[model samples]
Target: MSNYSYPKLFLFCIGGTGSRVLKALTFLMAAGVDIKASQIIPIIIDPDRANGDVTRTIEILNKYRDVRSKLEFDRNKFFNAEFQTLNSLDVATGEGKEVGSTTAEGFRFGIDGTKEGRFKDFIAFDKLQGANRALLSALFTEENLDAELKAGFKGNPHMGSVVLNRFSESEDFNFFASRFSQNDRVFIVSSIFGGTGAAGFPLLVKNIRSPRTSLRNPEWIKNARLGAITVKPYFGVKQVDDSKINSGTFISKTKAALEYYHSNITGNNSLNALYYLGDTLTLDYNYNEGEMGQKNMAHLIEFLGAMAVIDFMGLEDHSLVTEDSKAINPIYKEYGLNGDVKTVTVKNLGRQTRNRVFKPLTQYTYSYLYWSRNLSSFPSNQPWTKGFDDSFLTSQFFDDDLRQFNRRYEEWLNEMGLNERGLKLFRLDMGHGLLHQVIEGIKHRKKGLFAKERWSFSEFEGYLNSVDGKVRATALPALFMELFYMATEKIFDDRIPNSN
Candidate 1:
């Protein structure tokens, strides 16, 4: 009615980093995307089920009102909306506290026949009132889904179902109907590696894509979706200092999601999903699984940049293309579908770093697809990684600090699901003279290099040249480029090698 169409945003998260990520993204949306204060809706997905330091971190973010206030667009106008937490039964409480049966502010999905399903990890949604269920269906009905799927949903109030696909049709339809009308985008911020996020995401995607067909009808689901964000897990494998709890499953899930996006969201469908990765230098004390750093701030800036693009693109007058085809502003369109972008940097850092290993390497990753013999790295595609830690980065109390950034990026990914393939790291092992001589026979070409002040691709002859009494052969820059790109989209397989 306002003579404008708004792209709705949504977010889902897993643990400590998840909540923080939501808050950071909200800040970006309010600032970068410039959504009106009254128009934005924020949802946080907490792992109210996990046990670990990571869990504790998530709890803190869940309850941290002070932190939420810091992300405000305007102190006077913004509604200090808080996160709602989810439970093992797939129930949610408005304030993000684990909803117990006794609380009035809590809400649950109606699970009728989930017990009979084949899914071992079947979702058990909390029950809702019959009247509320009917009210939902009557309110948000659309003709897109087949009548059979819609008729399959059961609005029964007492069933414990996790998979909405297990619920009756009307209630399921009504839930997302309310959501879509109220909001356009949904963010599911969680570790692709974790039980909750992995299981929850595919289900969430299904409902939004097919609104009335969800299995369970919850009390407070509001609308269908225009888009989704998928945050991939970024961390080190379990080392003496860092544990592999989240990273282990997160890596594989992230990979699977990347594959999913690449396969489905072909061509113009890619406008929906986006990825963001955290860095590797974890913490000492609390670095059990989660870590944060200056890289997060950089990542935040990246998403903020993305929000800017989305916002600018969404504006009708900004482009000459018809509303139906182009995505207003997309990296793919900027460089042409196969543009092969080098890098996009956020200036005004007012900062500097002592050592940047992945610069040239990361830069090389962006300009071309990556190749590695390691299967784990998902080589043979462009490889990328996230980070260029800001002035705020530090090694002391590193876990907690890095935790902040993890949450921020996590929130961004939750709102924008992974709809395509992207590599996050790229590297070229320019071995010593002997190894280099042998490598030359394979015809390894140099694409580019990330140096101080700019990202450039120069011709290299498989050898380092010390121009100013300094060995300029560094891999950090390249790694950075690869990591960041990984968070954005798929790597070129021709460059990425089959893994080790």
Candidate 2:
């Protein structure tokens, strides 16, 4: 048995950006980014059942879980991490069978009466007393209250707070609390400007830190290691007819949310650690409040937000909160870059950030490119591909599941590259010779005819040949990942100059 015992990390992804960032984190984890936790449970909270971003993220998480389960845990660095839905964990613990049919279906918790109900009906405006009715009227416009609740709160936290308050009584919440162990930790990801995120973050934290008496293991849940990333406004949407969302209101909404957080969140020491991140260079997305049209391009800030989760998991126990009864300072963090360049490269990132991500991302990108482009043409005598027959290569496991995942991974990186403060890690346009295109900012100085053939399959094969002894015990995913890591590092030294 492996010496390493796995711990669980429960993640609450609150809204649209929350889902997108979680998707980015999933990709990074697949690339062997160290999250430090053994298992991750992602819980997505959004009213829009047909939300494009949320749906895509849930699909990715399901695929990740399926792939990881097939590759048995062997202390390998690649695909070593495990992902479980809250329902799976509950079922494992003998709490109950899952309510939803699939893992993606299990990811969401629907808000009662939101689908076809109006906000006024949701809050029972006619049933409230005069002062309460007046308060509600003052807080929400008729347009806001009369608006359909199925889509979302439309960037209004007033409606979200009322609707999301019911989450504590949810069956999923009970299951989550039942499975909560003393060693488990919780992390939240949300955008401060949007409705579901803005209202959900604080409420969710509050409940976790002060779980109700009815919840299983409430005491343990209260003391769990908690961390959160509150994303500020990082993108704008184009104005469209009858749209309630506006780019201009992002700052104001963020400011309002920050003020509330200061008093209720930071002032009260509600969280053990808090991470803040936003980009001044925001991307302009097509305007859509909800549904399939609301899909936004991946942004650099979302990547940074994902990084914060990894960083938080690495923090020493009690570093963010005091072990004793006395109050301790909460850890506060903000993302920064070394340069002000619009097109961000490796050098633009902080040394620590670059060091953590660069090598693994590069290696994974190389591995993916090789599999997609060169694997078929490479010599069959290669040890790694020796046992692989045409039927095996064409199997649904590889041709469908793994192939689709690789394509999504490439698309994820491409979208990030195209977004503002772009992470130009790979040249997205190239179809072949992808390793040379790995480092976008660096200049390659060719040494000779062989140098012109740098990053070729033969060179990659030669590097694999050199590492025969190191990979003697490694199998499939790890063997493949280890080979790519070794090959990429060698090529970096031989071909790319000034690379750190």
Candidate 3:
């Protein structure tokens, strides 16, 4: 799985929920989750250029790429999956033919004409003369016409559908099509009840399946192993008088979208696999109409939605077959927990989810705890610190990239735990029980008649010392990270019973 000879995956993340779920997927990749793709090209599609979720996700992705670039995918699985932006693949063509001239910062797929003024201005409402103007007015309300699109569609999918219709003609999308190769898969993440997502999902899929588009590799893209996750209303926004976004209309919008999808999306075999995820234990987040303030707390549903991506990648090619542009066996899936609870833990996750996530996440958490709390104050005599001097901590990889990345990791954990239907996977308040009680509901194995000795940071340190002598990497940063990775895996397996 660590080999680079595998197929590439083009992941299209569509809206605010799409950005948040992509963020969750990055966390999983950082933890070294077994994603089958050799390289992942994440194409974030959102018209809201300043969306807080998109900005934060793009930062995390760049940081992850920076950290991964410094390390080889040898023994360490952390950041093993390679990530690249669409613009970064412009050099892949051998004929000196360029992709396009879009000044995207290499992550976002910028749609043309979306950064401008109001909806009325975009549609040229003033130029329309008699019946055309009346028809437009009848279709759109006064508020919808006046709504500023610089932020987004403002919870109006109608506007988004119109604005995003020309997405296929954009340079970013053409670049994606040109770079697509054989066996490359595509996974789209979006929400079913929002503006950009609800409108973008069907349109994007339609363009991919359309033969009339002027994109490269139309045949390969049309029959590609495409999968999508349409996130339902898992969260709600607080009611504000001035805000156009209303949680009250979420379910109604979802129902309408579902009806359209049933007839056009699944009914026509537009996708090979479709995943649906929603949460009844809704959290009321602060209301913001698709701006920088639109950032919402991380939720368990997003994590599970990310799992849907991994599951799709892991599927056998035969399981997802297409004949005559129609699915022979279209797979529709939904997530289920072991129990219904407000606070979710590893124990609450289903067997497959637990088996996939429990150990990697725990090991990564332990690595974070040790490095953040004790790395700077390490004893000089320690075997792991022998070759590495004090200057090692000040290296850019350590001082800048890794430190900033770890801070984001901690923030992600806090946000997930603080959200409604919290995922309390790790006890962030480490002072209470430290390593032994860190992972919720997982107890450490004890030795001796008194059963007093438990797994501690000291024990973890010892494992690190032992593994330090065995691990090898090209750089000290990779060596350091891999040493902790190996030590955490070994210590967790030895000390935590039923860890397998």
Candidate 4:
């Protein structure tokens, strides 16, 4: 029996990632991944996805019924595909009911973002004068949100309650028995660059193959995903990175996401795998005129990733972009100006870089008392050099600048008393095992690195030997082992803050 469930694979291309994701989907078809007109599910979850341009784009394509569909077909004849409706933010009662407001209105962008929470809590706090937990309560459980969306259902109509419900509700995603056989490799193409990537990816994976499942094969969730990230370089499209700012507020949340999947699964670690692919000099893109290239490139990567699912069990990891850095500007850097990029750039490069770049500057940075007095001073969360580790970076690229950053990050962690477990949450970064699995698996399958653009087996025969003895891979175990020590030291020093 074939491992495929219905012989079709579903690649949910959510949010800002839709363009590239669709491109990757098409690539799979050309490579002979059995895809059909009715099998693939094209899901768009970005707030931007619902905007006029996107709607118009899809409409034009659908209306013509001839300019060729965006996505691709699979290698298996049984695999089929279809375009799904893009989800929208429920504005009516989703927010208005929970937060009794002066102006009862809702827009998908959600009030320009900062005081983010559920409608219930937004109401309780604004209209009801509720407590912090009460506000937090308005958020939905993670599991509910995951289940509703993954089931191919658009979320709650109003307030986009499912998104809110995800945060408050502790319930999470659960992975279970294979409605398919063990051989079917599951591939998810995602951007580790934005909100969905930061919040949704982990939840999706957890639900699919959660550590806690009821199935007989405790291994059901094991090694299923084989992580793949579409890392995009700094396009310089926007001056401030509001999306990244939003993500910044969720640092620990991001850490938790990484922790759930990044672990030491040595042999045949199945589901818990991931890789990255990036395009750096997007600098060539003109903000106003480069729309064509951006859209085209997006489709390309997405299709390639989808093809990887049908053809093999690996990912394309790269260094041009960062899963940690959204490759965008920081919004927090925008408050002082008239929102002019030129002016902002001057002020930031000359004055703000020191305080803003590396913050949590002083012990009193967060003092509400002092904060009230110095309302003009910008206080940022301390800089955490996430994803890039010390031992590994030193061994690989050996960049002195990076080593310095990692050193600073380690000091911060030491101060925070981040234990081994807390540290382990970060170990799933770009390293040997991740790259090895993808490369080795591809070799075993006799597939070209780029479907035919070179990269043969013999060329990669000694690829592993080229690096400084897999420095990054060696670092994982070390971090796991030493994490406990730092955690214990914090316990001894009693500096560990209560993680509420």
Model number with the top TM-score: 3
Which residue runs does candidate 3 get wrong by more than 4 Å? 90-103, 448-450
TM-score, every prediction: 0.38, 0.89, 0.96, 0.35
C-alpha RMSD between model 2 and the true structure: 3.6
lDDT of each: 0.31, 0.76, 0.84, 0.29
Worst lDDT window (10 residues) for model 3? 90-99
Clashes of 2: 0
Task: Show model 4 residue runs off by greater than 4 Å.
Answer: 1-6, 27-39, 47-185, 211-227, 230-234, 240-272, 284-307, 310-500
Clash pairs for candidate 3: none
RMSD of 4: 25.0
Of the pair 1 and 3, which is ahead by lDDT? 3
| Position 269, candidate 4: lDDT | 34
Candidate 1, residues 215-276, lDDT tens digits: the string is 23221232222333444443333345523243445456567656765554323442343434
Candidate 4 yields a Cα-based lDDT of 0.29
Q: What's the residue-level lDDT of 165 in candidate 2?
A: 92
Residue-level lDDT tens digits of model 3 in 1-500: 34466668899999999999999999999998888887888888888889999999999998998888898657898887788887776434323234665645678887877777888988899899899999999999999888777788878899889988979877767777778875788999999999999999999989887733466676777787889999999988899878688889999999999999999999998899999999889889988887789888889999998899999988888987766557778899999988899999888998888878888898898898888877775577779876687787888888788888889999999898988788989986776236788888887888547785365677777888888778888588888888888998997787778952
Cα deviation in Å at residue 312, candidate 4? 3.7
Per-residue lDDT of model 2, residues 1-500, tens digit only: 23135458899898898899999898888777777786888888888777889988888877776666545433334455677777676422323323332323467755557667888988888789889999989998999889788778778887898889987877667777777777778999999999999999989988887777776676667777889999999888888887798889999999999999999888878788999998888887888888777678887888899999889888887685534211267888998887888878887888778777876676677677777877764367776555446674575555676677888788888888888868777775655644565577766657466656335556667776676555533445445555565666666566666554
Model 1 alpha-carbon drift over 4 Å, by segment = 1-8, 14-17, 26-34, 50-176, 190-195, 213-225, 240-253, 265-500
